[model samples]
Structure formats: structure tokens, C-alpha cells
Target: MNETIARLMNHRSVRKYTSRPVERERLETIISAAQMASSSSNVQAYTAIAVTDPQLKDKLAGLAGDQPYIRECPVFLVWCADLSRLKAAAERHASDKPSYEGAAENFVVATVDAALASQNAAVAAESLGLGIVYIGGVRNDIAAVSEALNLPDYVYPVFGMCVGYPDPEHGAGIRPRLPLETVLHMNGYSAEQSGRGVQTYDETTVRYISDRTGGRRTAPWSKLMADKLTAPSRLHMKSFLESKGFNKE
Candidate 1:
């Protein structure tokens, strides 16, 4: 495989980090690379808030389910899906004030745009010998996080990312994904293709978990997923988003 492809394939989520800080210049480069990611209709509805302040990081860590990596990492980036700027811009330039920036379609566009940019940042950080992990727990207390970040209307955090040098002693193994056949489909999507490899994938995951936990945990992928689905996860997200002026209509 090519170098870039190889690097992509080798990606692993790093939860523990060394004390080394990411230089401002390098962080700027990563942000620039993130800016190069594709946006729907060039609206570019996203903003990344890099938190280097220890006090702020600690507060955010608590808001984000007390994930220690957030405070431990050199940089904690809160990637926000933002359309507030668009609304302001429209208010300034457009003759008509009848705009729908808060539409459901627009929400999807902003969220996807933010995610695209965040992934680009992740890849760029990885290229610079830094490790990164996405933190969805930021949404656990979405309102609190928004207050902490001072997010305005038409904007909300998509997720947080912890970026730094990975701790060698605490490095995690690369978790295996589902078999290619489970997802790859051609000629107008076939359910057969999707289901064909799940059993095999479950077996692979069972083995992987067994090895990772020293035979202490051997739950298959399907079982884990089922449990996750049954659990009440982030139930406040919908109401929280609505309170923050999202998905109106």
C-alpha cells in the first residue's frame, strides 16, 4: 500500500498521552489541512475551539463524562457545527431576511461538514507523529458544554478531540473492523452482501476481545452492538439540540 493509505490503515484511537505539547505552528498546519476538507455547497459550517488552558480543559473533561484523556492531552479541540456565521452574513448582505439556516437539511449539512473537517484534522495530526482520539462524550452534557464554550445560536459542538503524543506504555492495539464483505456492496446495494460476512466478523471480534482482555471478555461484535442499542445513550441530545435552536421543522 502507498504511504498515505498505510498511515490511514494504521490509525488507532489513543486514550493515553505523553506530556509533550503540540507546537502552535504544527497545530495551525493541522487546522489548515482541516480547512481543506470538502464542504457541502462551500457553506463551511464549522468551528474548532482548541483548548490549551488547563482549567478550561479540566472543566470540559468533567462535562465530557470525566474522560481523563481530554485533560491529559496537550490539546482538546471542540469541533462545532456552526451556522451562526451564515445567518449573520445573510443578515448583513441579503436584502430579504427570510432565510432557513436552522432547517433540518441545514443541520445535517453542518454536522457532516464538521465531521469531515475533524477527520481531516485527525489525519493531519497523525501525519505529524501525533496521536488523536475523537470524544463523543462531549455530548453527554451538551448544554453544559455549550455554556462552557459560549456557543451561540445556530451552533453546537459535534464532538471533542484529544490530541497529543501517545503514551508508549499505554498504547492500545488496532481494533479490527467488520469484514469488507459486510459493508462493501455493488450493483445497487445487496442485503446479501451486507449480511454475508457478519458471522465471520463476529468470530473475528470474539477472538480480538479475548486476546485484548486476556480471555476475560469474549463478547462478539453483534452482542456488543445489541447491548449498546438497548442502553439509553445520550437521550437528552434531541431536546438539547432543539433547545439550542436546532432541527426546527
Candidate 2:
């Protein structure tokens, strides 16, 4: 594989980090790389807030499922799917209020934009020898998180990320992914191919987890997935989105 592909394949979610602070210049460069990510229709409907204050991080860590890494890391970035800018632009250029305030498509586009930008930032940080972990637990209490961040209407904190130099003592190995055959479809699509591929992948994942966790967790991939899906999760997201002036229709 080429150098970029190799680097991308080596990604791991780093939970532990050294006390070393990421340099301001390097952080700016990483943010610039994120800004270079492609946006749907060039709307670029996203915002990233870099928080370094220890007190703020501590509060955020508490809000985000008590993830200590947020407080420990030198930088915690909150990625938000933002439509407030669009609303202002619409008011200035076209109308008194934004027309796409409650459009589901706009919400999707903003979320996609934020995700793409965050991935770009992650890749760039890794390339610079920094470790990063995405913190989706921020969504556990979306309203509280928004309030803490002072987010206005039409802006949702989709997730947060912790970035810093990895602590060698706490380094984790790369986790396995589902087989490409299961995900990549040829021509149109084939359920038989997907099913067979997933069956094999289930076995592969069992072995991987066993090896990774020293056999502490022996459940098959399918079973684990079934258990996870059986649990009610993020049930408040729909109403939360509506409250944020999204998907009102």
C-alpha cells in the first residue's frame, strides 16, 4: 500500500495520552487540514471548538460520561453540526428567516460536513505523530453539552475529540474491521454475498476479540451486535433535533 493508505490503516483510538501539550502551530495546521475537507454543496456547515482550559475540560469530561481522557488530554475539540451561520446568511441575503431551518436534508448535510472535517483532522493529527480518540459520549447528554458550550439554536455538538501525544504505556493495538467483501457491493447488490461474507467475518471477529482481550470476551460478533441493538439508545435524539430547529417537518 502507498504511504497514505498505510498511515490510514494504522489508525487506533488512543485513550491515554502523555502530559505533553500539542504545539499551537501544529494544532492550527491540523485545523487547517480539517477546513480543507470537502463539504456537501460547499456549505461547510460545521464548527470546531478547541478547549484547553483544565476546568472546562473537567466539566466536559463529567458531562461526557466521565471520560477522564478529556480532562487529561492537552486539547479537546468539540465538533458541531452548525446551521446558525446559514440562518444569518439567509437573513442577510434572501429572507427575514432561514427557509431550511427544519429540513432533514440540511441536518444530514451538516452532520456529514462535521464528520468529514473531524476525520480529516484525525488523519492529520496522526500524520503529525499525535494520537487521537473520538468521543461520541458527548451525545449522552446533548442538551447539557450544548448549554455548557453556549451553543445557539441550529447548532448541535455532534461529538468531541481528544488529541495529544500517546502515552506509550497505555497504547492500544489496532482494532479489526468487518471484511470489505461484506461492505463493498459489485454492480448492483447481492444479499447472498453479504450474508456469506458477514458469517465469515463473525468468526474472524471472535478470534480477534479473543486475542485482543486475552479471551476475556468470547462472544461472537453477531451476538454482541444483537445485544447492543437490543438496548434502547439515543431515543431522545429525534426530539432533541427538533428542539434544535432541525427536522421539524
Candidate 3:
């Protein structure tokens, strides 16, 4: 494999970071790479807010399930799915009133745009030898996070990312993924094949977790996922999305 492909294959989420700060130039380059990511319909409905202020990071950390890495990392970025700019552009140039306010497809487009852009940024950061972790916990309290960032209507903080030099002592090994056969189906879908693949993968995941945790844990991946799914989660997101004028139709 080429260097780029190899780097992509060796990806891992870094939680602990060293005291070293990421340079401004490097951060700019990473963001530039992010902007190069493909957007749905070329709308590019996303925005990234770089947070370097310690106090703001602290507040964000509190909002994001008290993840200390949010405060520890040299740089934190909140990626937002933004449609407010499009609204303004339409108001300025187009004759139509821009019917994005209540459209579900528009929300999906913005969210996908934000996700693609953030992933591009992550890959760029990793290529530069920087460690990073996506902070999805920001969604635990989306309203609070939005308020903290002063997000206006038609904008939503999709997630945050912490970027810095990895602490060697706290480095994480790559966790295994499902076999390609499980995900890559030929022509038509097969439930039997999927079931067989998952069953085999459950065994693999159990062994992997046991080894990774030094035998401290030994539960099948299916069980863990089942437990997670059983728990209540993010019911407020529906109302919150409506309040943000998404999916109103």
C-alpha cells in the first residue's frame, strides 16, 4: 500500500494528548483539506469553529459529558451543519424564499456535508502525525452546546474534535473491524450470510476485547450492542431538531 493508504489503515482514536501545541499553519492546512471534501450538491453546508480559549473549552467539556480531553487538547473544533448562510444567499440573489427551513432532505444534506468535511480534517490531521478524537458526546446536550457556541437557527453542532500530539504513554492500539465479507455483499443482500458473518464476528470481538483489556472483560460485541440499545437515548433530539426548524414539514 502507498503511504497515504497505510496511514489511513492505521487509524486510531487518540484520547490522551501531550502538552505540545499544534501550529497555526498546520491547523490551517488541515482545515484547507477539510474544505476540499466533496459536498452534496456543492452546497458545502458546514462550518467549523476552532476553540483555543481555555475557559470556553472548559465550558464545552462540561457540556460534552465532562470529557477532559476537550480541555486538555491544544485545539478543539466544533463542526456544525449550517444552512443559515444558504438562506442569506438565497435572500440576496434568488427570487424564491429558500424552502430549506422545513425540509428533511436539507437537514440530511447539511449533516452529511459536516460529517464528510470533519472526516477529511481527521485524515489530514492523522497524516500530519497529529492525534485526534471525535467527540460525539457533544450530542448528549445539544441545546446547551448550541447555546454555548451561540449557534443561530438553521445551524447545529454535529460534533467536536480534539487535536494535539498524542501522549505516548496513553496511546491506543487499533481495534479490529468487521470482516469485509460481512459488509460487502454481491449484487443482492443475504440475511443468512449476514447472520453467519455476525456470529463469527461476535467470537472475534470477544477474544479481541479480552486480549486488549488483559482478560478484564470478555463480552461478545452483540451483547454490548444489545445493552447499549436497550438504554434510553437522546429522545430530546426530535424536539430539538424541530425547534431548529428542521423536518418541520
* Cα lDDT of model 1 by residue, 140-237, tens digit: 99899999889998999999999999999998889999888678777678777677687888899999999888999999888998999999999998
Worst lDDT 10-window in candidate 2: 96-105
lDDT of 3 by residue, 1-249 (tens): 999899989999999999999999999999999999999889999999999999999999998999999999999999999988888887788856555545899899999999999999999999898989999988999999999899999999999999999999998988888777889999999888888888888999999999998999999888988999999988889999889988876
Tell how far residue 184 is off in model 3, in angstroms.
Answer: 0.9
lDDT of 3 at 190: 89
Clashes of each: 0, 0, 0
lDDT (Cα atoms) of all candidates against the true structure:
0.93, 0.93, 0.92
Candidate 1, residue 50: the lDDT equals 98
Candidate 3: stretches off by over 4 Å: 95-98
The candidate, 1 or 2, that scores higher on TM-score is: 1
The TM-score of candidate 3 is: 0.96
For candidate 2, write residues 1-249 as lDDT tens digits: 999999999999999999999999999999999999999889999999999999999989998899999999999999999999998888889895548756889999999999999999999999999999999989998999999999999999999999999999998988888788888998979999888887988898889889988999878888988999999988988899899899875
The TM-score obtained by model 2 is 0.97
Error of 1 at 107 (Å): 0.3
Cα deviation in Å at residue 50, candidate 3? 0.9
lDDT for position 106 in model 2: 90
